[model samples]
Target: MIWKELKKQWRFMDGVVIASLVVLSFVPLVVFSMNHKENSAKEGNIAIISIDGEEVDRFVLNEETKHKEKTYYPGKDKYNIVEMEGTKIRVKEDNSPDQIAVRTSWISKPGQTSICLPHKLVIEIVSGKSSDEKEEDDDMIITY
Candidate 1:
């Protein structure tokens, strides 16, 4: 019935446009799925902890990872507590008022992230690199 109504009000060009838009919508899904698969295939996922845009620590998210919490001091009296265990990580506590990162709970996927703007802290999960890949990237530079 909907198609019949559309047919009466629409022309061939309209149908072509709608079909093109529908196909276009799936293009991004396909692209993102491919990228996700590539990242998820890494041997182990890694959680990167950054404060003020500099990486301070990284933890391998795997079954053997110990259950522990670490406190980071980004600035004077500004701190964030991160906890990790069994392939999952989270911001357990922080000095930020909003507590958004803490409420984000645990993140286990490669692309998940938690940010605390007030503390300038960020925790992100990323795909792990093999030894050869790590060696190749060792030359990457950092600036002051």
Candidate 2:
């Protein structure tokens, strides 16, 4: 009688093992399908344009460009530091009368140019081209 009960329990256990194997086989397939769907919906095209004086650089970014900001260190000359925004720019200056012009244009959108410079640096912005000679004596310009 005990032998008959053991045989009956083994029959039910065999079915449970087969059911688990079937469920396990479907798990990887489900995961792969979801991953494929997500990858297909991702964006793959983006571009960034950078220009410094006469030099131009262009490249692509994997993400969208809702907004962007860039700072350029032309050199240690303090007069070369520039910040650009969309087509607008601002340049820093010391007490130099050299004509420095910065032009920025986006390749993706042509016909848009931005010019930026310190108010004191622009010849038209300032009256009679006066220099900020006192600025050189400020505490900010002096270093220990």
Candidate 3:
């Protein structure tokens, strides 16, 4: 009697496993098909530096060759060095224990960013040019 019950339940378990496998296969395809847009500071070739939600400085990456800016936070001894090399930008030196920002790769893209969370500082590349000014249609889009 026990063997019969076990054999009957095995079929239902097998169906559940098969259904799960089918759903898993489709998950990756759906994820890959969707285009994820990043929120960017639209200021063109400029990098915005903000500290504690306030804009502290902005740098034009193209004109600026190579330099470093030290950020000092009041009441805190922590400091972060924002470095720019050619068109690339990164946190070159940080006193934070993890040094995650220092370890991050340099970014050159218009929308790329590097952050030092300990100092509450964010560095983001911007286009400087507003997208709203262009009213003409471009060939980059395709319609059915």
Q: State each candidate's clash count.
A: 0, 0, 6
User: lDDT of each model, Cα atoms only?
Assistant: 0.88, 0.39, 0.72
> Which one is best on lDDT?
1
lDDT score at residue 77, model 2, on the 0-100 scale: 43
TM-score of 1: 0.64
Worst 10 residues of 2 by lDDT: 121-130
Residue 136, candidate 3: alpha-carbon lDDT: 52
- Model 3 misses residue 12 by how many Å? 42
Over 1-144, each residue of candidate 3 has an lDDT whose tens digit, in order, gives 999998877888798999999999998877754522122222337778888889988887663456655555623788877777766788888788788778886987767888888778888887645566444534477679
So what's the TM-score on candidate 2? 0.25
TM values, all candidates: 0.64, 0.25, 0.56
Runs in model 2 deviating more than 4 A are: 1-10, 44-144
Ranking by TM-score: 1, 3, 2
For each candidate in turn, give its C-alpha RMSD to the true structure in angstroms.
Answer: 6.5, 22.1, 8.7
TM match of model 3 to true structure:
0.56
